[model samples]
Target: MQYSISQDQNGTHLDWQHKNVSPEMIDWFWSNMEKGFLLWHPEEHEPLQWVIPPKHGNLIGAVHIAPQTWSDGKRQNLYIRFEDFNSVPDAIKQYIEYDHCIIVAGLGFGEGSLHVKEPLGYRIHQWQSDVQNSNSVGVIGKSNAFGWKKSENHEQGMIWAKHAGTEISNWGLFLPQLFDLYKVVKNTKYNPFMDLSVKRIDGVLQYKTAN
Candidate 1:
């Protein structure tokens, strides 16, 4: 599916429509993202594990290390740190509608020493609560999830936007099914028996539907 990309003084913007996204999907994203990410987009994404798992089980201050294949075909390792939404400056907050939204921010960096390397940029993702468990929430701008980096050129920004849009769409497609399996494990005393596999259909890798 093709997603739209636009630009303004703020930065490059991408608008994607992911239908039937449930609250369970959101819960899965925050908690089991390391697993779900590869399941959703096996072609593009590499394994992303937490370098610093959430302290006290809260997302704020958690850190993850991952590598991304850029549009330029260069793979770069990224160290990302999640931050509190309240710390966002007013200038950026003005453009975001925070009411009833799951507001999240991440500080991104490329390879090299943590203190020595310049920051890649900040990522702000805000999703409306109402969009969850709703159908036909078409083109909701608040659900747009992509990082707008300060150092990236317009071309690079668009590439990232497109990549994010594709990833988000894939998650929306398979999350409900994945969430059902997750509930089974939770209910059955953490049964370690899951027969999940990825299959390629029409050149896109996707989770095989649970029988």
Candidate 2:
């Protein structure tokens, strides 16, 4: 396992990686894991594997793990904030009525979505876009970051509506893995532990191929 635990005033955050992980290891992490988690897709596997822990307490925010498939046929895996997944800001929760996975708000603690916290707010450096593109992909929430545009092009992760009292981007941009997840499954509400903890969450996301 690989990990990095850091410290700040509000609390201490830990990030780590584990190799040869099974289902139990993943259970331990989500249960004992810190509040901050973000993984990247390994960038090698065509499609990887990932596991989503059951709803932990109140999910503050979360993103599907990424860098997901770069191991020896095992798979690459990364992290997304837990808040994004658990907060799931919709009533019907139809981020994709067809798919079943919904993108919720994240640490979007400041300007981007909602959440008034300072440190977690959307970082100006992390937020960028090109007004140049007048074309987008969807209708409801097209432009990423802050839905800055009213057109269509490649608004990769703009899927769900935001929960009130929060300002985090609940959109799941094409993180390579999620892009593939969107293509394959029935949804992303994964609670079944098929003994996979060190795999990419994107590949793990369960989607049903349209018959």
Candidate 3:
């Protein structure tokens, strides 16, 4: 599969040609693209601050997201933000924002489809353990994040996950692993997230999602 990225006044756009790309994948890509656009212009929303605990003398950086308030009064937002931990000269003292970050997780495309990972659900399970050990905030709420696996071959794609509040401790520890996973999966020739365990499949290009 071949893909290209371009930017215009409208925002960044992705164009690709692939044989096995599925309808579900196209929908996933477009939805994520819209979310990306919103992040750049999140002036109207409230920024939620995330704080992770210190580990081995190194403190993970904080994360912020502008959550959209629903008509029913639910505040929710789904997006991706990546920060480089190694670049921080002093992780113990810095609180970095999303302004300098990139979408390193939560979005992927290959094998003729798009993939979104729901590590937050897995995070919730970890949080449960933390709560058992008295290391968490102990507040349980509906995960602002919810989705299903896109491909049949992989047990993991995007799944459902519960979201704890912004002040959850030790949550930042998951960043490095998640980022590494993103780097590996996105660059692989075959989409491991897809069924058939193949990256490029023989099929037809019915149409293009974006020109």
lDDT of 3 by residue, 60-171 (tens): 2212233555333455454333223332123111222111111222222231212233322111111011123243222221111222222211111111111122211122
By lDDT, highest first, what's the ranking?
A: 1, 2, 3
Off by over 4 Å in 2: 1-22, 31-87, 91-104, 109-114, 117-155, 158-211
Local distance difference test values of all predictions, in order: 0.53, 0.26, 0.25
Q: After the best TM-score superposition of candidate 3, give how far the Cα of residue 60 lies from its true spot, in angstroms.
A: 7.9
Q: In model 1, where do residues sit more than 4 Å from their true spots?
A: 55-57, 98-119, 129-150, 187-211
Task: Give the clash total for candidate 1.
Answer: 0
| Stretches > 4 Å off in candidate 3 | 1-44, 52-62, 69-75, 78-101, 106-211
Q: Give the TM-score of candidate 2.
A: 0.21
RMSD of 2: 17.9
User: How are the candidates ranked when ordered by TM-score, highest leading?
Assistant: 1, 2, 3
Clashes of 2: 50
Superposed by TM-score, candidate 3 places the C-alpha of residue 55 at a distance from the truth, in angstroms, of 14
- Per-residue CA lDDT of candidate 1, range 1-211, in tens? 3347777655666554455664335544654567576766666778897776653234555577766685678785677765444554544545554222233434445434344332345655544444443454322333433344445567777777867776767866777677776765643222222112234456433323322
Each model's Cα RMSD: 11.0, 17.9, 22.0
Worst 10 residues of 3 by lDDT: 121-130
